[model samples]
Structures are given as structure tokens and as C-alpha cells.
Target: MSSIFKWEAKPFFDMVTRRQTLQAISTTALPALAGCTTDILDSGKSQTRYTLNIEPIEVSPVEHALFDPDDDALFGNPAQTALAAILPDGRHTTYGYEPLPDDAYVEYEGSYYQTTNLVTGRKQMERTLIRAEPLPDKADVPNDAILVDELNRPAARVVKILHSNAVTGGEGNSAELLREDAYVLRRPVERESRLATGELDGRIVTMTDGGNWAYRLHVTHKRITETAHTTLAIEVANSHSQFRDVVFGSRIDVELTPENLSADVRNLLEDAVRRETYEETVPLPETFEALLTALGLKAVDTAVTGKLLWYDGELYRCALYVNDSS
Candidate 1:
């Protein structure tokens, strides 16, 4: 397949926990774990049964020249063969020579194909369009906000931490919260190559389309290290298997760079960026509770009050996390 729903790829997650089980979606019935218990889903209470199904997206050698700034992208494939018009008798030919609907199929040589997507090739009609976005810098936390890889390594540059908002008991007034991260790479024909965080059981992600590339979008969160008086650590990385216990003066010196991200992780991030872009807005806070469950994150110290989401180079206020560490 070419793409997935908005919440398919979870960037900031550790799926190798002892509390999860693998299940086949097609063979077995999916449990209704949407709102059962946050303990197992969030704070690692019991265990979770979830997996990520990721697909690669095609990216033009040149950036999207016609895509709008507000538009988010998941994936794209270039239309080959010249345009054509479908005749009442099933004949197909080039455009401008004959009037035709945007979605009409065209013929080339001896074969017939669909018309090119709008604003491309002929720059006329709308094609398959969706909404997707990858990691963008948060305007509030320009200095503190950092982009990391799947290994929780810094994928982008190190911004100065002007004010700490990714800390406990604080509003994200000026924080570049981790919202979405894009991974670009070859199509994940194998299980390990796919953009997955939790239990993926035995599903296969095959790239059937001629499009050779793939992209995935992920909303990953970095580990939060808080001290009673000061914030010690706040960076995205898959360093620890789980959230490190709230430590007092000690801070783990993570020196990982973007390149340090595993090949699969990086590919997942890029693929997310190329998939799609949409304009519909959802209640992030209300949906974030389930989102954390999907990602397999637990709450520590204090219960989750609210979250900060990074999108379109801005941080949006979001929902609370887990209630307890089960």
C-alpha cells in the first residue's frame, strides 16, 4: 500500500517492552482497547496489543513545487505516459485537443492510463490528496526543541533551551513539542524495515505501485527528565528501554546525532513526511489520551495534565497522558 491513516507511525516509542503481546489482525479479532484502561496502555499497567503498519511515499527529485505551505503530505507517485481524451467509442488521445473530465482515463500508444493529478503534468485536476506532516520546529521552543531519530538521537541541530516547557507541572508556553517526525527511505518490504513501534504481529507491507520510494509520519516524544528544582533532561531519543525514573541531579549525557538513528527508523521518519497533507483540525487533547495508549507510554511522577504538540512550526496544546504507572 502507499499510505496509512494519520496515526499509523509512532516515532517516540519503545515496543520491546515485556508487557505487550503480538496478535494477527486478519486472523484474530482486535480487542476493543481504545478506552478500557490507561494503566496498561499508558503506565505500562498490564500490557498492550498494538502494532504500526507503515508504507513508503514517493518524493520528487525536486521538492513539491506546487504544494501549499499549509498542506501536509504523506506520499506521491509521478504519472507516466502522455495525457489523452476518452472518446465515446472508447478512443483515448492527448489533452487540449479534446475536452475531458479531470478523472478520465487516457490512452498512450496501445495502452490507456488515468489523467495526471491536478497542478502537475497538465496542472489541471485534483488527484489523490491526503493530509500528513512531519517534524517541524516549534516557534515557542526554538532553542529547546530538538529533532531526534528513532534511537532518540538528535536528527536535526541542537537548539538552545531558552525555557524549559517539556518539564513536569509546566505549560508549554515556549516549547517545540515533539509532534510528528517524517522518515524517508526504500519501501519496507520486510517487517524490520516498516515504520512500527508496538506489536506488528505478522502483517506484510508490500509496495505494489511503480513508485519506488516511501515516507512515514510519526509523532514521537523524547524522554522527560525532571528534578524538583531544575529540568535535567528533555530530548527525543530511544536511548532507554523505558522512561528513566525521575532522577534528582544526575542527567544522562546522550551524544547521539540524527545519523545515529537506525536505518529503519530514519526511513520511517522520511516516509511519514511524503505521505499526505490535509486541512482538517481535530481536538488533539481529547484524542491524545488514546494516542499515548497507541504509542505504549506510561506516566510517572505526576499524572499527565496536558501535552504540547508541534505542528506547522508551532506548538499546539494537547491532551493529558496517563493517570498512573501500572
Candidate 2:
């Protein structure tokens, strides 16, 4: 006659790996941050502050389920006996047992028992607590068909079997980790009208003779306040159109909101933008000979001109190879 048995082995450390993975998935949370903007200044004059508000984007959560494991073979066989094994405490070795052909067994409260199945014409052995450990101090157990922790938490112990059946026991559940947040992208919606003297501060204009000139542009606004993520465009115009072109660099203090943007991140983007804007041309001493030698030119007779252009979205290019003698 075929004999039946049951047993439990540390709930199978495999379950431990699965639980750890679940725990990890349960703890990952990332905050959705937003809001970015830039302002432009015209000469010495500043633009009025503006505010813009828009709809916010909302985030949501995802859900799923968990499964239990199987535990069998410890109570159906008669020859099964508990085998001493290492426990979690290391100081003590616990015993684990399964059914065998020679002895009938049953298990309860760390004990074993053997019985006969008269209807089935067979014998069975079982283990009550072959390998059981105390619940973690921070964990709680729960009530349900599934084995849970002290906190009514499920699946503290699990044993997986064929066809994904629970030959033993465990809990299966899923939960969300990241909380929901909203994002709002705003642009300057309105501006206040003010009188201007038509002069901008800290601006350079060239004279008809190609001489350097400095002009202070006047602005109507004394201060400005703007909402986050608002980009402002300021137009620079020369009433006199005296200079063929004006070339100069200026600095302005910009305030950014920390609510949605980190300082380090904004700083990084700003540094990159500044690096691409200006060219630190190292002019070869007034000596044309030095220029020829530096450029690897065969002679100083060739006139070399450099022009740089800046495009939207940080795009830039140089026309260094503009001439052809082929």
C-alpha cells in the first residue's frame, strides 16, 4: 500500500527570496518633481514680473496579488523522523522530519504522530512544527486560510509545490509604495505695461567707425515676480541702429523655486548653458606671423574670420572652414 507523509523545511529559503523581493517592490518610492523656467534681460533694463498657472498632472498607483507556498510529505509516511538541523539562532540546532516507510507519524506543537487510514488502506505520518521560527519582533500575525504574521500580515511561511500549489502554506497580497503627486507647467500669462526711456543698462553699441560704445538702457519695472516654469522673452532694439553689431556679456541673478527643482540640478544646467554662450578667443599677439604659425597656415596673406551662432535649445556651430582655394 502507498503511504502518505508531511513535513516543513524552514518554509524553503526560496520563499525568503520571494518575500524579500516583494518587500523591495513594496518600498521603492520616487517623487515626481516639476517646474522650470528662464528669463531674458534687454541691455541694462529688466522686464516686469509675471505669473502663470496651469492644470496639475496627477499620479496614481498600481496593484497586484501574492501567492502562498506548499508544505507536504511530513505526515503520510511511517519511517519519517525529525532530523537535527541548524536554526536561525545558531546557538541551537532544530530538528526537521519527513515520513518514512518504517514509522507512522503525526506533528503538532513541535511533536510528531503516526496514524492509519483504514478507508484508504494506507498509513500516514505528519509533523506539527518540524521547522518553525518566531515571528520577527516587528511583524504581526493575521487570521485567514493563509499563514500570516502577528500584524495580520499574510504568508510569513510558505512552501511552493508542483503546478504552483501550496503543498505547505503562505500569504499572497500586494500594495503600493509611491504616493501620488501632481505636476504643473506654467508660462508667463500677463505683463504690466510701463513707460520706458528706450535705454537699456549695461549694453554695448558700435559706432559708424567700428569703435566700441556703451549705453545704459532704461526699463519701466522696478521689480518683478513670476510663477515657476515661466519663460520670458525680452527684445533688445537700438533706436539709433548706429552699430552694425553689438557684442558683450552680462550677468543677472535668477531665483528658482526649490519646491520642484533641486539646486544642484539647476546649477548643472546653467553651467552648461554658460559654457556654450561665450568664446574665449586667445588672439595671437598683434604679430600676423604668430597667427600664421598658430593656425598652421602657409602664409599670413590669407584673411581668417570666425563667426559663431547660437540657436534655440542649446544648438551652436562655428564657420571656421568658410573659404576654399581649390
Q: What tens digits encode model 2's per-residue C-alpha lDDT throughout 1-326?
A: 01111323356445668777555434431111111111112223432221111111121100000011123332321122221111111111111211221222223233222222112122232211111222332223322212122211011111111101211222212111101110011111101111121121222222112221211112222222221211111122232121111111111012223333345534432443455321112222233223223223323232332322222222222212212221
Q: Which residue runs of candidate 2 sit more than 4 Å off their true CA positions?
A: 1-227, 240-243, 247-289, 292-326
- TM-score result, candidate 1: 0.13
lDDT of 1 by residue, 248-292 (tens): 012211122336455554444334334321111122233333333
Q: Using TM-score as the measure, which candidate wins?
A: 1
Error of 2 at 60 (Å): 53
